[model samples]
Target: MATPQWSKFFPDFYIERLWDKCIKCRRCVSECSYEAHIWDSKKKTLLEDHSKCVGCHRCEAFCPTKALIIKRHPSDFREHALWTPWFIKNIYKQADQGGVLLTSTGCALPYKNYFDHLVLDACQVTNPPIDPLREPMELRTYIGPKPESLEIEEVNGKFRLKKKLPPLIRVEAPILFAAMSYGAISLHVHQGLARAARDLGILYNTGEGGLHASLYEYGPNTIVQCASGRFGLHVDYLNAGVAIEIKIGQGAKPGIGGHLPGEKVTEEISKTRMIPVGSDALSPAPHHDIYSIEDLRGLIFALKEATEYKKLVFVKIAAVHNVAAIASGIVRAGADAVVIDGLKGGTGAAPTMFRDNIGIPIELAISAVDKRLRAEGIRHRTSIIASGGIRCSADVVKAIALGADAVYIGTAALIAVGCTMCQRCFTGKCPWGIATNNPELMKRLPPEVAYEKIYNLVKGWTHEIKEMLGAMGINSIESLKGNRDKLRAVGLTKEEMEILEVKHAGE
Candidate 1:
């Protein structure tokens, strides 16, 4: 068969070459939702729009031509030493007076191995293994306050409201999608998360950017975040969610304010956030009204009053030294739950030094916070959610075993929908459109496909979690929370061992 004339204009040479090998099979074009490939009848060729290609590999996988091959462009770095370290070092020295090392993603810092050094325990010969398929395992969890003690009472000729509150909020799964602000990501990405959350029966967080009007339908599965700027905050915004999260800090830029550059503050974002167009939306590190724990509590109560005690209020803080003490104060401040974000948590943009050099690890923070809460006899009053570098199902299980009521996944969710984590999210030039603010780039991530990928990834992880729980002979995730006894420290120092309160294996 002659090569189709429509294949001549393909922007990607590789795709064009592959199109030339097509044998009139519609499989590749049919499987791709973006209509990346089209059969041109007049030209007798398969045309491809490389710009719409998300690099999902669905077409390549289904192509019978063995013709489609997606790959990264080759780099010739050695050919240009001007861009190398020595040259860059001199440039940095010359520019050092005022230049900041700008970065646009999560921490790329080398850190302590708290999560990796610790290990989980499985049943041995002494303990018979349980079959996950045959057993009933529970991953159900609640994410708010629990009663310390309950008293049964009956009213005169009537029954009073139950002393114990119907678990502040129950979740069928212990994994949730973390906050990726609307300004940082696109509307389709947010919509995808919301749809996936509804399908999976889990919750999706609206980051500090404020909830968009189009996503209000997913309210029951949404956790709206209220950060320092208080963007788009109003009576309707307050009432439009299952829970409210107050962002005190983020793991990526703990001690710094968040600056969403004016370039990305488009009309939609401006309206959603109630911020003016062409002005940087700044989120200061500390709320001006909150100077102390007491002040924090006051704000918490103010929000509670504003919402009429209908929503569960969550206080989110970055993991840092003395985070345990901070968590205790947040719990005492009347937060229904506390979200701890460790150093590796993601960001749209932050100074490179801050992203790499700040904050503690989630594993250590979770362990320390749980211990402190229990020691203070306040563990029962508030739940704990952990986010930062949660890469897999094993991470989720280990986080819960270390004492997280749930694990929040941001990067993983982005990866599920084709993010390469190139760390250029702030540039608004995301090739897959998962992180860009540009409308043309943003539209690359179609809601239907992106949502499906997220749903599949979470569903796969959930099944793996069930398998792990079954193997551990634990039926419910609650039974696993804070069960450090099931975990063993492998390569810890005396101080680290003491802090984690775990022993080396076979000791």
Candidate 2:
């Protein structure tokens, strides 16, 4: 089988060999799977085939004498400010393959981060800041339908609440592990996430990948996704999850289906996903069963019924132009929680065009949906979980203040487990082993090590959230949820502020 030829649009990489430091040990040649380094026995020299380099840094890091230097291939193309080097390179890449340009990890394109523009308020002389060490600060959050008001009724000669509220999944913090499918990442990574979710007392999603049997024990903290493929779904699978998420779209690839290449569908993954090994695991763009809001509602209730009405049913969607209206519909349709994945979310693989240039920012989406739900008098009926580029505790705080009941962290979690965001997940050769499924590479990242890293990351973020809450003279994360008054926008237009429902910083 011959592969299609493609022009080298971007300089794949450049390598510099320092003769003085070169030990000729060929460590670089041994480490680099790209075949970027070579040993010339005739000349007794170490040479670099830089064209093979993807700038993964595997060889450069392993060189004992540090004899090799790896750099991005210089963009020698005539510089046009209007049509940047990246734009030109992309054009050339597409021109060569005439196929969809697949990319992985988060979009590297510089998009406006709305969370950065929004500032959280702190206490002043009028309101003294509470000492977090001495104060009772609360971060526990519940995701599900919240009753507007509880009515007391006489039951068995005793006054009791008429209707108990819907079942809610409680978390110690307002951050849950975002969905990154099993096929996208490694089995060890999944194990780490399962352990982390159980240890963190939060939730980790089984992203459309189907539940690995090993993770069934972590069921109480897992949210199993039901996407277009309906992969790995059965009575046992449905019952294993504490919650069921109807994944309509993702932040990175809105209106696009997921494609796990045939090579990635190994026997284990195939069995778990109920698909044939070495076959493409393709998910459709939209759920064929769902077309209208009524259809979406029907699916949500169907999941509830399938779960015997005990599990929380969540609807996850990309932050699109009509996100607010969509969220309203989702809530009215009986979804317990709504997850809004913003434009900047990470993915295992997505088309370059859609990943870079699609979807709305998360901050704006949360505000709009929160405002719309409040106006419709159904704000309490569904919780909001915001995901997409939630980097720090500040981002989480800002998201909650804007309207999110909780935040979902994906790329950040990967980073904690040694993902460098090289944007090469599609290659199935992640150097850090977080994204790759290859047995050798996957073993480099032990489940214990990854779990510890995740625990530390979550713990650090939790403490930071508490610190911020104490500074704001608020002790509970729930108080911060949808408290837009605590947020002020900087360098935003009146229309933006109106949409954000936040005052200008000076105001």
The candidate scoring highest on TM-score is 2
Among these predicted structures, which one has the highest lDDT? 2
Q: Residue 149 lDDT in model 1?
A: 78
Q: Report the C-alpha lDDT of model 1 over 1-507, residue by residue, as the tens digit.
A: 754343222222134436467677777666655666788889876777764554556567667877777553232235564475434533454454455666666788568757788777777787765776787777778889888877666878776656648337667799899988998898999999999999888999999898899999999899998888888888898888889998999898898878788988999999999999879999888888888989989988888889889899999999999999999999999999999999998888888878888999888899999999999999989999999899899889888888889989999999899876657677665667787667776777799988999999998999898888777777788899988887788878878877777778777
lDDT of each: 0.82, 0.88
Off by over 4 Å in 2: 1-6, 39-45, 153-160
lDDT of 2 by residue, 81-153 (tens): 8897777767777787788888986657777788879998999999998887898899999999888898999
Report how far residue 146 has shifted in candidate 1, in Å: 0.8
